[model samples]
Target chain A: MSVLVVLEQRGGKWNRTSFEALAAGQKIGQALATPVTAAVLGSNIDSLATEAAAFDIQKVFAIDDAALEQYTPDGYAAALEQLIQASTPKVVVFPHTYQVRDYAPKLATRFRKSLVSDVVDLKTVSGGLSYVRQLFQGKLNADIPAEGDLQFVSIQAGAFRAAEPASATNPIEQFRVKLDPSAIRSKPEAPYREAQRSVDLGAAPVIVSVGRGIKEKENLPVVEALANALGAELAASRPICDNGWLPMERQVGSSGQTVSPKVYFAVGISGAIQHLVGMKGSKTVVAINKDENAPIFETADYGIVGDLFEVVPALVEEIQKTKA
Target chain B: MKIIVSVKQVPARDSSLRVDAQGKWLEEADLTYEMNEPDAYALEEALQLKEKLGGEVVVLCAGPQRAAQTIREALAKGADRAIHIEWEERAAPDALTTAQLLANAVKPESPDFILTGLQSDDLGYGQTGVVLAELLGFAHATIVMEVEPQGDAVRVKRELEDGWFQHVSLPLPVVLTIQSGIKKLRYATLMGIKKAKTKEVKTIPASQLGIDLNSGLVMERIYLPTRSKKTQIFSGEPKQAAHQLVEKLKFEARVI
Candidate 1:
């Protein structure tokens, strides 16, 4: 049985997580002792297909159609269903991206098959493969076993690192599938950057980020003072940005920007998985929150179990004194 | 116009999670339950649409009997009625099974629109909405941040990763998974709560849906995440800890 990896591309360039999914596909192929084929979908994606050909796999299947120029659940699902039906790969893999979240389920349902979404890891069990997925916002992980001959898996973004693909001089092939124009019931507009992003937090040497524990918006200056005292950039979790206390550009999380500042100070952030993936790469992480049991403590290098209102002011004063 | 909003009951955010004895689910003996956060947003979106378009808004849920409380909450928030699909205790159904059951429960309604949470706070599979759409054969969108109804189509704003947004127009009879914090949720007032007692909630047994409950994925194990780092806890007065933190930043981390 062969394995198939669905490569996601927009316009022409590949989505960032495509490589991650390919890496996962390679690993799964190795575990299952099967050859892996990566398929690129969309119209005029020859450049992408050429790029994917470099991967250390069998062949890159470029499935192109005019109806796929823009992403719509119905259009992509119908085309992919035809491809899967014809090829009949034992397993299909995808990167658990927003785009995949929109269409993978629809594609799986067309075949009456179950889809295992947002998996973090996979293990080779005695019988078959078991995938690990998180529950309760990362509090618990469940090992889910596949139930059918044909299965679908979506690897979470950042779950695997993209490896260097071996050069393939002749590994690119073109495949076509029919998509009914009348069946596509949605018209997509051009994607746009919601904000100009005045502040690029990823480049900052130090970042001071706050969360719901910071209390009211009026108290934001407390953390801002700490940021200023250390010459660090001001950032926040989703709630702070959602409340308009900080601009959307200042938000650091999955839906926001991913930052790897040198020294990251997370004041009162509970370290939800969505927020953790963005800042976990920081060189040094220090978290301060009144709740000692907050999940932030699990990842922080140094943790202070105290009120941010008191701890942040003292921190600012100490930093100012040290500079003086 | 008619709308069906799917909601779920989950452990409250503040509840401490403990692995059950079987190591396949949570120990919920004492945990408080509340409406899944994103599903509440979806219900609010449906209610707002009904208020604007002068249509009927019906709530649908699949869970244990305890979920009736969640259905009542949606009814209190102005859902005209509710349908609760009662499942066996501790039934760990995968996304497709759940979606199939929902599709079965939703067949008789044939509503113009269906709305659901982007994902549940508990399982977080985040695939039910799209699966339901495909099973029911409707145009669908996920992470919908805004919805504006046209005559026979709806223009929706969807949130993409990394602060990007997309606008799409989908024909009527569509499915949408609402993003959290889309709009302020309205509370159930005393009068509304009293009226909710009279609202209709029709409970259907999951076995009767004719969908195979055992035809989906199986959970082999569930456990707490292994800690990746050993945190050094700072112990002292708030000022003293802050002073030490600053010193460490200057010397150890050398960032400031």
Candidate 2:
């Protein structure tokens, strides 16, 4: 048995989700006694070939084509379907990303199989394999098996650990698949980055955020001072973002960016599941809310139940003193 | 233009959940079922689109008889009519199967566009929209926040990571998965609620809709989630404990 992870890249850059998929695949592959290999489809993916070796992957299959320059569901799905057929993998892993959402099921459908998607946990069941998927807006979880020998699965963002680059002398293979022009039904245009967001939070490691507790936009300076001291980016909750206290990009919620920062300090922000779904996987969660009963406290490793107006300044002073 | 919005009924978010003795899904006896939150957004988006673009909006639901309440709610909010594709509780097929069924059931109508929630509150598979697009061979996009009819093509804003957004234009006859909270959901008007009872609600079986569970995907089992919890305490004075807790948050939980 072998497992294949479809590593997704955009604009010639590997997405963080691909890393999450590799991490999930490594564990599942070990449990199933199958080696984990990654299949990447893009134009000149060889440029990013070194990036693939960081994961504890057994092998790397990189397919190159001009039609794959941009992300089109048909082009990528066709490429993956052909790649999977050659590998005959028992399980397919993907990040529950927008790209996967577009085509994973179609690829599964072509093989007469179905997908068990957005999984939060992967376990070795008594029979074969089972995965835990969250339901009811990140509340209940249910275990489901692939009904057959082959299964397709997508993991929730940040569900798996992207441990420090796994040290392995994993070999890379150039997988050249014959591409049928007809299979590529859609031609992708050049990827255009939306001009709205000034700061792309996808890559930020440290985020200092204030939420409803800050009261107004003027109070943002208090949190900004802390973020500046820590050399971290400043973000906010939905209410603050909605009220234009910060740019929409700084908002961490269902409607905003789904981030997994190394350190996320949420000040005066109530932890709604919608917000939690985006950043709960942060490496460190620290919350400061005036209301001790705030939901954010449940998820915070360190909870500060106090007024952000006073606590933030003190925290900023402490951090600045440390820096000095 | 005629558009179809696919809806699913799900337990209310935050509703306490439990598994029955059969190791199957819990009964919603004490719980209340509502039109899945994300789906309500889809219905709202479709209704708004129809209002502006001059078209008919049809709400499609696939579930038990009780799910008709959800459809009635949709109808009362101005869905021209409703389609009830009935199935047993256990018969709630996987995303691929449901997408196939939805494609076949709606193919006869040949709606110009189809919209559905990014994912359901119950299963949260988030696949049916994309699968249906593939099954019907329609150009598709998922997690759409903004949609504007641009001549024959539709311009859409796709929600992505870290406040990132993508603007893509797809030609008509497409499928889109609507994101929640993109637009305000509409409530049924008193007049519309009274008129919904008179609207046509067609009932069809999963089988009659050319959706055979035999050829479709099957499930092996469904069980409860496994959970294990542990607690750790820092022994010291209040101030020291607070410092230790912050340190743990940074080093251990990595959630600071």
Best by lDDT: 1
* lDDT of each residue in B1-256, candidate 2, tens digit only: 8989999987765455666566566665757788987788899999999988988999988888889999999999999998888886555577877888888888898888799998887777778888888888888888888888877778888876554667777887889899877776678999999999999999988878776654544334454433241224333343444455555654676444
Query: DockQ, in order, for the candidates?
Result: 0.73, 0.32
Question: Candidate 1 at residue A217, lDDT?
Answer: 93
Error of 1 at A82 (Å): 1.7
Q: Tens-digit lDDT track for model 2 on A1-324?
A: 688988888887777767888888888888788888888888888857667866677788888887777777777778888788788898999987767877888788777677877787776777466777765545456677555678788887757876356766567777776666665544444444456777767689899877777887787788888798778988888767655667777878756777788888888876655688778768767787765545566676666766667666766655554446
Tens-digit lDDT track for model 1 on B77-123? 89999999998767868889999899999989999999999999888
Clashing residue pairs for model 2: A257-B163, A264-B256, A283-B254, A283-B255, A284-B254, A284-B255, A284-B256, A285-B255, A285-B256
- Candidate 1 segments exceeding 4 Å error: A125-128, A290-299, A306-310, B235-240
Q: What is the C-alpha local distance difference test score of candidate 1?
A: 0.87
TM-scores for every predicted model: 0.95, 0.79
- When only the first chain is scored, the TM-scores of the models are 0.91, 0.69
